[model samples]
Target: MRLRGRKGIREDLEQQQDLVVLNPEAYKGKWRERFNNDYPIHVEFGMGKGRFISQMSVKNQQVNYIGFDMYDELVRRAAEKTRIAWNEAELGDPTTIQLALANIENIEDIFAPGEIERVYLNFSDPWPKKKHGRRRLTHPRFLEKYCRLLNTQGQIHFKTDSETLFEFSINSFADYGLQMTNISLNLHRDGINEEHVMTEYESKFMGKGMRIHRCEVLVGQDALQEYQKSRLDKY
Candidate 1:
């Protein structure tokens, strides 16, 4: 399903002139100076509709946020929100957010080594077909790319309603030697954990009485090596 834009979303981004890089190669090894901040970096992949990333940026202004999504329309909306947040942040306003239009699979080309501090995979496509399992966002192939860009202490946060996908991701993390922390099979049953922020999808699902599955995976060089070695034939 496609989403339509409200008035001013596109125009807002144009007015702000925020740096929204579409080409992955253009950002290779150059993101640090772009935002003019050396603070820790966090990313949200498939930032559908921009709600989660924008809200997180407002909550944590110290961490620079770079959201990646392939959909041009969605990216534009996200860029608008980021620009708004950035402006507010500059004017002593809270929340600083940035965005990029790129695929998660090209993450290594999108950010340099040791550049990323954290990653959030919020309600990604489950890719239910067995034959298409490799395309799953949490598949080992993509995890390898994440590992390459994330710093040694970087961590990945994932939330989804698809039980199968969550199980698959859990196994992938274990296979790659990533330590899993704070896993919740039913996030809402116990109330939203303070650390568990709601994405657009997460909020919608919870409203419909569906439970959210969440987990965190620590990323490091060793995990990256194992992920790459295991996914060689698949990728």
Candidate 2:
């Protein structure tokens, strides 16, 4: 799916404000206002093409979903997929879902502390080299950022196909003292596909007979309290 983008894709995407958010930072702490609802907000980092988040948003109208990516091309694809999904279901308004073009490195700048209810990392870049460990999305620094944005009962779900990356993430989460649950070494084999949403990359790996590893880490009250103490906390 990584190829040259179609011409004028950025312009087309920008015009779809209902699907692709603009100046996301402006609505940082007021995400619920942007959605025009009080529903909890959940986000997916590195949301390649929109399969998971779009479907989740359509299925779970009670929660607001946001997908973020650095590439304008990918964001365009995500918005198109969301529009198609909404249209297929005879839905006119897409107030529950939004796709944004932004890098996760400065995620904290886009959302205020305690504004997010859930954080999802699906098939994220492994950054395999030891020297690049900090660059991984599950790194402590990034985890801290997630914690800051997550509520006391916030959750972080991670999925990956690389055993090396999975192992690294397990250790990283443990070192951060985060509590993990419902871990799946082989998600599809565990008969849990019904509860999971497969991304485009995940489907490709599955088609190749690759196993997907998944885990969930909860941000305990203590962690959230600590984050709040250090931040200009927002709801």
lDDT of 1 by residue, 119-141 (tens): 99999999999999999999989
lDDT score, candidate 1: 0.78
Q: TM-score: which candidate is best?
A: 2
Which pairs clash inside model 1? none
What does the lDDT read for residue 226 in candidate 2? 59
lDDT of each: 0.78, 0.87
Model 2, 74-130: lDDT tens digits are: 888888788888888887768799898888987888999999989999999998899
TM-score against truth, every candidate: 0.82, 0.91
- RMSD per prediction, one decimal? 6.8, 5.9
Error of 2 at 177 (Å): 0.7
Supply the TM-score for candidate 2: 0.91
